[model samples]
Target chain A: MEINGVTIEDTFAEAFKMWGSRLIITAATEQWAMTTAQAATGFGTSIIGCGCEAGIGRVLGVDQTPDGRPGVEVLFFTTSKKSIAPVLLVRVGQCIMTAPTSACFNGLAAEKTVAVGGKLRYFGDGFQSSKLIDGRRFWRVPVMDGEFVIEEEFGMQKSVGGGNFLILAESQTAALEASEQAVAAMRQVPDIIMPFPGGIVRSGSKTSSIYKGMTASTNTAYCPTIRQQVESVLPEGVNSVMEIVIDGLTEGAIAEAMRYGIAAACQPGVVRISAGNYGGTLGQFQFHLKQIMA
Target chain B: MGSQLNSEKTTAVSINDDGVTLRLKAPITLPVEAESICPDCFVGCQQSEILALPVFCGRRRKMLGDIFSVSGEASDRITVEGDLTHFKRIGQGMSRGRLTLRGDGGMHIGAYMKGGEICVEGNTRDWTGAHMTGGMIRIRGNAGHFTGAAYPGEIRGVNRGTIIVHGDVGNETGARMRRGLIVVEGHTGECTGAGMIAGSVFVFGKLGARAGAGNKRGSIVALGETAPMLPTYQYQCRAQFGFLGVYLRQIRKWGIAVSDDLLKGSFRRFSGDVTALNKGEILIHD
Candidate 1:
C-alpha cells in the first residue's frame, strides 16, 4: 500500500501491556498548568532508563477542568500496576506539588486505583485535612504558598506501550521534517503520547547489543553509512530514519494515532514507512502498517 | 427575613408518579414515630403490607394506614405528602432507595441512614440525619438544629454522607460530625459545627456566633458575614485556598449558585478551638 506515493510497509509494531494513569493538573492559568505538567513529565521518555514513560497528553480549557481553571492532561505508564504508585509519589511530590498555583486530580475513572494524595498529605505534617465530595475524596496539604489539593486516589488501567512507526526518508532533513509532521498529527489523537524528544527518536535500537550488560543497541541494518559494512534494510535511495514511539491507554488509541501520524508523514522526500517488531514474539499487541493505513 | 427563605410549597400528593405514595388524611398535633415511612421498609413488600407496617403515634401502636392513605405499588422509591411536622424518624436506618417528603417533617428525619437519597421539599426539625453513615439528604427549606449531628452518646455524627440545607438552620448544625459534608445556603444559628470532629460545613450566609467552638479537625467555611470569633481561636493567615474551588464547583451542581469572585477568591484562615485539639480551622471569605 502507498500513501501519497510513500511505501507503507507490511510490517507491524509490537506493543507490550503496561499500566497507565491519567492526571489532570489545573492551575490559576494555562501557563502554570503546562509548567507543572511539563515538570512532572520531565526526564521521562522510556521506562528502561526513566523508571516510567510519561508525556503531556493535551491542554484543557477552563470549562473542562474540575476546578474550572485551565489545565493540562498528563499520561504515565509503568511496567507493572504496583510500580505506578512509587513513580507517581516521586513525580507528584517533587514536581507537581512544588509548582505554583497547581492542583492535581485523577483524570481516569476506573475500579482499580492507587493512593497519590493520601500518601502525600504527610508533607503537611499535622495540618492536612481531607474533604469527601460526591463520593470522591481530596486532600489539602498546606504548602508555603498555599494549600496543594490533590485527589486521594488515582485510577490505573491496563495500557499499551512501545507502539512505534519508523519514517524512512531520502535525507536527514527529509526524515526530520516528516517526523515533526507525524508528531504534530499524532498529538491530536487522544489517550496517546509520543514518548520522545519532539516525538522523534533518531537512534532506533535492536534487541541485541555488542557491549556487556547492554540489552539494546543501534539498528545497524537501518544505518545508511553501514550499508556496505552490513546487510542493511535501507534501499539505495534511503539515507535517514527517525522513529516515533507511542504509548496509549488502549491498543485502539495507538492504532488511531499511528494512522494520523503515518498519513501526515507521507510528504515529499519520504521514502517509506515501517515499524519495529521482534518477529511478533514478545509484545502482546501488534499494529500492522498497511492495515492501519487502509 | 424568615419569609424570604421559604421554598415554594409542592402540592403534588404523589411526587413520583411511579413510586408508592403515602398521603396524610388529616393534620395531627401529636408527634408520631414513623420510621416505617422509609423506602427501605417498603422494599419487596406488597401494597397491603406497606399499609400494615407498624408505627407509634404518641406512644400508641398504630398501622401506617391508620394515619395516611397509602397508594401505588410496592417499590424501593416512596413519596410522602401532607403535614408531616409531627412525624419523626421518617427514614431512619434506610440503606437504599429514594424517599421524598413533600412537606415539613419532624425530628431525626434520616438518622442512622446508610445509603440512598432523601429529599425534603420543606422544613425539617432537629436531629435530621443524626449519626447517618452514608447517603445524601437535601432540605429545600429551613432545618432545625442538630442537622447532621451525632446522638447524645455517639462519637460520630453523619459519619459518611452529605446534607445540604438550602435555607437557615438552627443552632449546633453538624455538631460532633466525624465525616461528610453539610452545606447551608442561608444563615445558621449560634454554635454551628460546635464539637465537630472531622467534616466540612460550608455556610454561604452569615456564620453564627462561636462557630466551631470545640472542633478538633473540621473545616467551617463562611462565605458571607461571620460572627465574632471566640478567644480560643487565633488568626492564621489570609491566602487563597485551592480546595475551596473544588468544593464550590461540586456544590454548584446541586443548584447552589456560585459567583466567579468566590470561586477564585482568598480567605482569612483562623485555626482554633485551641481548647480542644486546635487542629480545626475557620475560613472566612476575604
Candidate 2:
C-alpha cells in the first residue's frame, strides 16, 4: 500500500500490556501546571532505562479540572501494577509537590487503586491532614508555599505500550521533518503518548542483542550506514529511518494514534513507512501497518 | 423543596388530627423509634402492615396506624405530612431511598443514617444527623442543638454525608464531626464546630461566640459575621482557595444559595485550636 508516494509496509507493530495511570495536575496558572507536568513526565521515555513511559496527554481548561484551575493531564505507564505507585510517588514528590501552587488529582476512575498521596503524606512529618470532598479524598500537606493537595490514591488500568511505526526518508533532514510532523499530528489523539524525545527514536531496537548480557540492541536491518553489510530492509534511495513509539490506554487508542502519525509522516521526501515487530514472538497486541493506514 | 418528591412513587402518610389530639397511644415510652417506616425497609409492606409496625410513644408501645392514616402504594419514596414535633428517630439508619417530612420533626432525626436523602420542610429538635455515616439531610427551617454533631458518648459525628440547613441552628453545630460537610445558610449559636475532629462547616450567616473552639483539623468557612476567635489561633496570610469553587458548585446543585463574590474572593486564614491538634483553619472572607 502507498499514499502520497510513501510506501506502506505490510508488517505490524508489536505492543505489550502495561499498567497505566492518568494524572491531572492543576496550578495557579497554566505555565506552572505545564511546567510541573513537563518535568514530571521527563526522563520517562521508555521502561528499558527510565522504568516508565510517560508524556503530557493534553492541556485542560479551568472548567475541566477539579480545582477549577488551568491544568494539564499526563499519562504514565509502567511494566506492572506494582511499579506504578513508586514511580508516581517519586515523580509527583520531586516535580509537582515542589512546584508552586500546584495540586494533583486522579484523572481515571478505575477500580484498582495505587497509593499516590497516601504514602507522600509522610513528608508532612505528622502534620498532614485529609479532606473527603464529594467522595474523593485529598491529602493536604503543609508546604512552604501554603499547601500541596493531592489525591489519596490513583486508579490503575491495563494499557498497551510500544505501538510504533518507522518513517524512512531519502535524507536525515527529510526523516527528521517527517517524524516531527507525525508527532505533531499524533499529539492530537488522546490517551496515547509518544514517549521518545521529540516523539521520534533514531536508534530503533530489535528484540534482543547479539551480546549475552544485553536484552536489546539497535535495529541493523534499517541502518542506512550498514545497508551494504547486513540484510537491510530499507528500499533503494532510503538513507534515514526514524520510529514513532506510542503507548496508550487501549488498543483502539494506539491504532488511532498510529493512523494520524503515519498519515502525517507520509509527506515530501519520505520514502516508506514500516512497523517493528517480533514476528508474533513477543507482546500481545499487534497493529498491522496496512490495516492501520487503511 | 417538598415539591421535588414524585408523588407517583411515594407513599403518603397523613397524621390524624382528632379533636382530642390522638398522640401515639403506646405501651412503650421515650419518643418512639419510627425508623422502620422508611421506604427501603418497607418495600413490600402494605399501609396496614406499616401502621401495625411497633413504635414507642411516651413510655407506651403503639401501632403507627393508631396515630396516622397511612395511604398510597409501597415504594422507596415516602412523604410524611403532620406536626411530628413529638416523633423522634424519623428515618433513622436508613441506607437507601428518599424521605420527605412536611411538618416539624422531633429529636434524633436521621441519626446513624448510612445512605439516601431526607428533606425536612419544618424545624427539627436536637441531635439531628448524629453519627450519620452517609447520605444527605436537608432542613428548610430551624434546627435545634447538636445538628450534625456526635452523640454524648460517641467520639465522632456524621462520619460521611452532607447536612444543609436553610435556617438557623442551635449551639455546638458540627461538634466532633469526623467527616462530611454542614452548610448553614442562617445564623448559628455559640461554639460552632467546637472540638471538631475533621470535615467542613460553611456558615453563610452570622456565627455566635467562640466559633471553632478546640477544632483539631477541619475548615470553618465564615462567609458572614463571626465572633472573635480564641487567642490560641495563629493568623496566617490571606489568599484565595481554589477548592472552594468546587465545593460551592457542588452545594449549589442542591439549591443552596452561594454568592459570586464569596466564590471569587480571598480569605484570611487562621490556624486555630493550638490547645488541640492545632491543624484546623478558619477561613473568613476578606
Candidate 3:
C-alpha cells in the first residue's frame, strides 16, 4: 500500500524482550540536573554496542519534582534483566553521583524493585544514611558539596526494543531532516527511548549473519550499494534509508510513538516509509504500519 | 509491648509480672481490643477489675482469640517483653490503657486514642501513633520511620497527640502532624516533621537532613548540627532564644537528661525548603 507517493513496505520490525528502569534525578539547579541526567543517559544508544540504551525523558520544574528542585527523568533499557544492574551501577555512580547536589529516585514504582542506589551506596564508604518515606526507602550519601540522595532501588519491567521505522529519501540531508521531525514527535511519549545513533539508524540489520557467529545480517532491500546485485525493494531513485528504533515498557506506548514518528517522517523530501520486520519470527508485539497510520 | 487478644470479652487480665509473653494473638490481622485500654485503665485490667474497668484494646471486627495469647495474671499494669518486630495496627484508636513493654511495639501505637497512654521502653517501629487525633505515648528509646505520621497515602497526621521519644527517630517524623507536640531527646532522623501543616518537634540531639523541609506551620528546635541542610532553607541570624530551653525541659519528662546551655544559647533561624512552598524553618541553636 502507498500514500502521499511514499510506498508503505509490508514489512515488520523484529524486536526482543528488554528490561528497563526509569530514574528521577534532581540537583541544586535545573542546569546541573539536566546535565547530570543527560550525561548518565548519554553514550547509550543501543544494547548491541552500548550494553544499554538511555535518555533524558523530560526536564522537571521545581514545582513538579520530588525534592522540589529542577530535575530530569531518565529512561534506561537493556537486553536482559541481569545486564541492567551492572550498567546502571556504573552509569549512576559516574554520572548522577558525581553531579553536585543531585538526588535520584525510582521513577517507576514497580511491585518488584531493582537496587540502584542500594548497590551504589558503598560509594559513601561508612557515612551513608538511609530513610524510609511513604514506604519507599531513600539513601543519602555524604558528598563534598553536601549530600547525594538516591532511592534504594528503582523499578524494573519487561519491555520491547527495535520497534523501528525507516525513512527513505533522495538525499542524506533530507533523510536527516525527516528523521529529526520524527524524533521530535516521538518525544511526547513516556516509558520509551529512541536507541539509535543520533536517534536514527542508517544501517538496519537482518536476523542471521552469512558468516556464522555474527547474529545480525545487513539490510539488502534498502542497500543502494547492492542495488544492482540484489532484488532491491527500494523504489527507483531512492538513495538513502534511516531507521528509528524504540524501546518501551508497554507495547501501546511504543505504538503511539511509532505513529507520530511515521507521520512526521512522511513530510517533504521523503520518498517512502517502511518498517524492518523479521517476518514475525521475533517477539509477539507487531506494529502493522497501515493499522497504526490509520 | 505488642498484645494479642483471645476471648477478651471473658478473659481476666492483671499484670505485675516481671516477664510475660503477650504475643500478638493474630498475625496479619487487626490488634486485639486489649490494646485500646488507657494507661490508667491498664491498672484496672491488671488488677483483675475487668468488670469495673472501662478499658480494652479497642473495637475491631475480629475476636481477641484471633490475635493474642494471655497466660499472665490480672493486675493494674502489665509488662510485655519480647520480640515484636512484625506487629502492626496495635494500640490503634485507643483512648485509655496503662501498658508497659520492655520490647518494641508496632505501628499506630495510639491511633486516635483520645484519653489514654502507652509507654514503650524500647524502640518503636514505623507508623507509630500515626494519624492519632489524641492521646499520649512515652517511648524510652528510638522510634522507626514515620512516627506520628499520617496513615499510608493519607493527607494529614496526628491531629493531636503527645509523643516523647528518648532516642532518635526516622524520616518524616511527625510528618503532616497537625496539632500536637513531639519531643525527641536523642538525634532525629531525616526529613523530621516534613509536610507538616502544623505541630512542633523539639530535638535535643543531632538531627538528620531536611528538618522541617515542608512545613506550613509548627516549630522544630534543633540542639545539634544536621548535615545537608536543605537548599530550600535560607540561613537566618543566630541569637539567644529561651524557647529552646522550654522545649528541652518538656522532653526531660521522657528521661532525656539535658544541660542548660541549649535553652540559653544563640540560635540560627533559617526559613525554607523554599523548594516547595518555602515555609519551613530550622532553628539551629548552639
Report residue B248 deviation for candidate 2 (angstroms). 3.3
Instruction: Give DockQ per model, in order.
Output: 0.65, 0.44, 0.05
Once fitted onto the true fold, the runs of candidate 2 whose alpha carbons sit more than 4 angstroms away are B1-33, B71-74, B242-246
**Best model number under TM-score:** 1
lDDT of 2 by residue, B155-245 (tens): 7777989899999999999999999999999999998899999999999899888889999997899999988778988998988775676
Model 1 DockQ reads 0.65
lDDT of each residue in A1-294, candidate 1, tens digit only:
888999998899999999999999999899999999999999889998899999999899977898889999999999999999999999999999999989999999988999999999999998898988888899999888888999999999999999999999999999999999999999999999888888889998888887999998889999998899988898779999999999999999999999999999999999999999998999999999988998
* lDDT tens digits, residue span A274-293, model 2: 99888878899999999988
By the TM-score metric, which is better: model 1 or model 2?
1
> Compared with the true structure, what per-residue lDDT tens digits does model 1 show for residues B62-172?
998998898885566888999899999998888878999999999999999888899999999999999998999999999998999888887777798999999999999
In candidate 3 chain B, where is summed lDDT lowest over 10 consecutive residues? B1-10
State TM-scores per candidate.
0.96, 0.90, 0.60
Query: For candidate 3, lDDT tens digit of each residue in A1-294?
Result: 666666777766666788888888887678989889878988898677788988778778755655556789889998888888898899999988898777887888777677888978888896564543324556667677656778888898988887889999998889999999999999988877886666788888776667978877788878988988987988877788888989888888889999899888887788988887767876777888888888
The fraction of reference A/B contacts recovered in model 1 reads: 0.69
lDDT of 3 at B223: 74
Clash count of each predicted structure: 0, 9, 43
Candidate 3 CAPRI category: incorrect
True interface contacts reproduced, per candidate: 0.69, 0.42, 0.00
Please report the candidate that would top DockQ against the real structure: 1
Off by over 4 Å in 3: A1-3, A210-213, B1-286
lDDT for position B233 in model 2: 87
